[model samples]
Target: MDVLPDRAARAEFPVGERQLIMKKLIINHDRLKEARDAFARFHFPVVGGVADSGSISLVMGDSRTGKTFGAKSYLGGFPQRPGERGMIYPALLVEMPASGGYRAILENLADAMSIAHTLRMNNSVLTNNILRGLEFHEVELLIFDEVQDVCDIKNPRLASDFKRLMRKILNLEKASIVCIGLPETYGLLSSDKQLVGRGGLQYAFLHPYSWDSDEERKSFRLLCDQFDEGMPFLNKSSLGATATAERLHWVSQGIIGLLKNFLFIAGSLAINDGSIHVDTTHLAQAYDWIKPPQTSFNPFRDDWSKKPDTVVTTAPLTTHDPFAKRKRSAHAQ
Candidate 1:
């Protein structure tokens, strides 16, 4: 009995797309440079400002714009030049508890430094551990992720308390602290009034292509083209898949998160097929699976975006802060 026309069907076709996601590049390249430049500007000894004057940048953009990676990668670039020390000691990357206070945040910082946090629910010990970790690493900057999970701005009492503690411990005199979170996080940051008064280079806003110029679109596409698995290689994009590749930017909405996932899954499927080249059919499957190639993060509604608009009215994290931080939410989703 004749089986079928296609025989070696189950082979890897788009291996590159399936693995090397575009999101990683955004984090490692596009965003990293942003942080470095911002920090460099503020690192000035006499930038001249207020109590805490340095360039404490806030990258609040649409969700999936690679905010986490953008800020986190800043950790790896150290020694910001000789004699130019970073704020944090050894680099403490903390994730605030969804419903937590100073204690929970300190605990997370300790964990990031790989130090044993003997908090056992003890705030003092937790604080001491973090201090030691920071001192050990001579850390210059403290990075907190999912800061939005910590609170809402409407509550005056909570907001006041949060501000007091942050100033006393984190901001105290002059420590460059970087907060990583969705655009809403910036709202929470500004609600403190005092926090916002310090001044920050606000970004992290995903444009959603609302007013993108042609050059901007072309540049981003060019970057993605470098890694487009449907294409041939760096110099030659979509050598065989050129026709289908044209729509890639439109489908991915220039959002790294969307593009990465689209390529990864579809690329994997193609790779599994072991085809030497991808066809429009593969792009369709990828597009369908990707759902939103051009998805944007509407920070106001939820889940994720830009300069951070008006602060949302909610109480800041107090004694009642919970363990349900952003990671927990991410896990839940």
Candidate 2:
């Protein structure tokens, strides 16, 4: 049963990820393998790192830098060892709400898992059951993206409980956990020594590829080429050898996650207007579309001067108006 695209997508899932597919955007097979190998080694990022071991991790980056994308890729490839078959290993991925905590985290998982039983209010028992279900599913790994929520743990003890849940993974019949979020994730780890010390599970961090690097640009171009077939209309090819990956580098602030939304918006526009391909104009519009609203401006301030000059104040006078000539004709006659 494949999930097909439709308008109800908004009603069904969160934004950005409703129709997201890593294969649709990046050739991360090699990068993906590096993470898996690192996990096997117990290296800082791979094994001994906070990212790999902390049951809850905070993976933060500019909007689109592949933080979520990388987690999805890992989830897709989790527990790849042989004899891993007949394993009903369940892999559950859920977003941490903008403001989140251990309770929200548990509830989201419980709901996503669609467990038959009720999770007792703030009960750790159900949380453990959630962990046990993964074991029953033979799921070897657990990945929770949008981890910035770990910071939402206000119950001073909530953080400890979150860590405790992670430690339980070690107690599982067969399971591994990966928590990803923004830089705040590291802060969460620094506060808890015991949580950071567990077999020193590795923290795998995926950095944004430098679109300016000749090498990096080459890869991005290759991705452009790979996607050309699907994006038959987005003639990213025209930009070709000269395509300024740097522009994307600057705009996306070098986050692989950001590129997906930026490009998708551009591509969707081209599709709608029946454009032959994606061009600079399409890119510009996409830039606006993908930009999250600024946090600094206060609508209540009533300070017009504080608003960005770029904010539109009036529709530009248009030549295409059907009534423009009629007014002139009346005057001329």
Candidate 3:
């Protein structure tokens, strides 16, 4: 990622500077760091020409909570290197197709590994090619983003087929698998005893920060401070101030992606007006542009703190372990 120009150089910059700055910024917030650590733990190093059995790890989170971002960031750490045969990829990250069929899944994997294949190729051949490509590229970790598409299938037959394909991949022990999706993706492991048994069914979660918890509030404030420092402006924006942080949390719902976007617009507005720093006035205008017209609440308003409905809190989405009872039963046996 490109670093922004020095603060002194950024002063009195043109209106388009916001685009240049925001495009290059990539913040590794706390939750994203946790997700990366989980990926690292799942990857096992080979020894004495032998590797441990491939395991499956699930990374579940709400939309825009940085699940995909974190996965890609982990992939970025393992750049493709020149191998005796060709380029070796230590890790691969591919998205689950909306259709979520076995063939689509294989095609997506092939595309990511840069393996050539025709649309007419049979499933068996394609599967073999993908597995071979995984070995050929020496991939140690395979990440599947939007995995809920396959896990949430309504048709039992489709679901069974997908699970069967996954079991085969795990059996090969070519690479550890990481599935990234909504919390509902837990169903994939709960429904399949074989998968759970094979991988121990490890789980990781990414969640938006909340203002209620003191720890979470402090973390959110620190994130705001980091973003404030990252923004290329002549003067500090004081984004981490108590009042400002609360307003930012309100508008972005503590999601980093949303926060970055909201701030980008606000920063652009400030730049356009030749302001030295982003202010509430610019934030107010940016919110109007990004939010729906029917939204009555504006956190940037003077009386925002006094408004009755100024803060709206919603519980984070969570998954209950469907296998808890089964595990207890097995232990009793």
Candidate 4:
């Protein structure tokens, strides 16, 4: 496999500044791979033996649990082996804007299809162009990431506009739509009766493994083992060790995003400090860099014999409306 040159490397940066861009991590664990496969196998239903008609499939998870990765994998899986199929685009992924509305969504779709003149056109014209472009490009799956952004807007009509847009796309194009976001995204989709009726499948990525369940703990340990194997330090740190794993779970509060950040910080700190091993001390420094809420409980304290109180309170991942105050004020009058 030929490794592509980093585009960032070509850009001019100060000597020391370039080092910060080089340390990037892409974790390809088994679980993520499985989700990708399942997403790929998803077939649009043939109603009354007619093909090309599809439904919406949603992939939901807490923040940073690989929702985008899974969607990207499915979108990137087209033509299977390279050159087998010529210019076949099986999936198209678009991100919903932070203050999403009908026009913004149409513009995004038009941009993804590489259709110009969309900016000058009206909504009806743009819709036709998008439909034509999707058909021309042979797009079977359409994905909208950060879909919760629509719901986060102060304008209640924005959500309904998105729902209407999605329903129209499904009816006209007969292509399946895959929306990826947090639990709130599911709520947004489920609110629409028409969207839910058309075979809406909810695939949720759960929170980090919990000690409350033996199966979840075992699964988490397996994940830790994979990370341990991948750790580049010369000294092998048994991340899967009972005590170490527990500490990690507590500090990370079972979120994969935090866990990844924790490891990255730990590795960078260890390398900078001239340490060949990544131990509790390195992780403690990593926590400081990460700024997780629990600063008092350092996992790598000198008292190695006892476990520290590192329990973290979990919070919902939804972004609230910025104009919520204005709406409340209006209602008060």
**lDDT (CA) for every model shown?**
0.48, 0.50, 0.76, 0.64
- Give me the runs in candidate 1 sitting further than 4 Å from their true place: 1-32, 39-55, 79-90, 99-102, 119-121, 128-136, 153-162, 199-211, 229-246, 292-333
Models 1 onward score TM values of 0.64, 0.61, 0.86, 0.78
Q: Supply the global lDDT for candidate 3.
A: 0.76
- Poorest lDDT segment (10 consecutive residues) of candidate 1: 324-333
Clashing pairs in model 4, backbone N/Cα/C closer than 3 A: none
Q: Which ten residues in a row have the lowest lDDT in candidate 2?
A: 324-333
Q: What stretches of model 4 exceed 4 Å from their correct place?
A: 1-23, 44-52, 79-87, 292-295, 302-333
Error of 4 at 303 (Å): 6.1
Question: How displaced is residue 177 in candidate 3, in Å?
Answer: 0.2
Better of 2 and 4 by TM-score: 4
Q: Using TM-score as the measure, what is the rank order of every candidate, best first?
A: 3, 4, 1, 2
C-alpha root-mean-square deviation, each candidate: 11.5, 13.3, 7.6, 8.1
TM-score of 3: 0.86
Off by over 4 Å in 3: 12-14, 44-52, 308-333
> Tens-digit lDDT track for model 4 on 236-295?
578888777766776565656667767767766765675655777888777665443543
Model 1 lDDT at residue 156: 52
- Weakest lDDT window of 10 consecutive positions for candidate 4: 324-333
lDDT of 3 by residue, 1-333 (tens): 566677778664664665677655788679889888777766643333433457888898876788888888888888999999998998889898877477788889899989998978888898889888888999877888887776665756656766777777788887788888888888865678988887788888888888877798899998998888888788889999988998888777788877888899898788778788899899888877755444466668757545444333221332233112110010010
Q: Write the per-residue lDDT of candidate 2 for residues 71-104, one digit (tens) a residue.
A: 5655564433334433353455666555456677
For each predicted model, how many residue pairs clash, with residues at least 3 apart or on different chains? Answer: 42, 37, 0, 0
Q: Pick by TM-score: which candidate is best?
A: 3
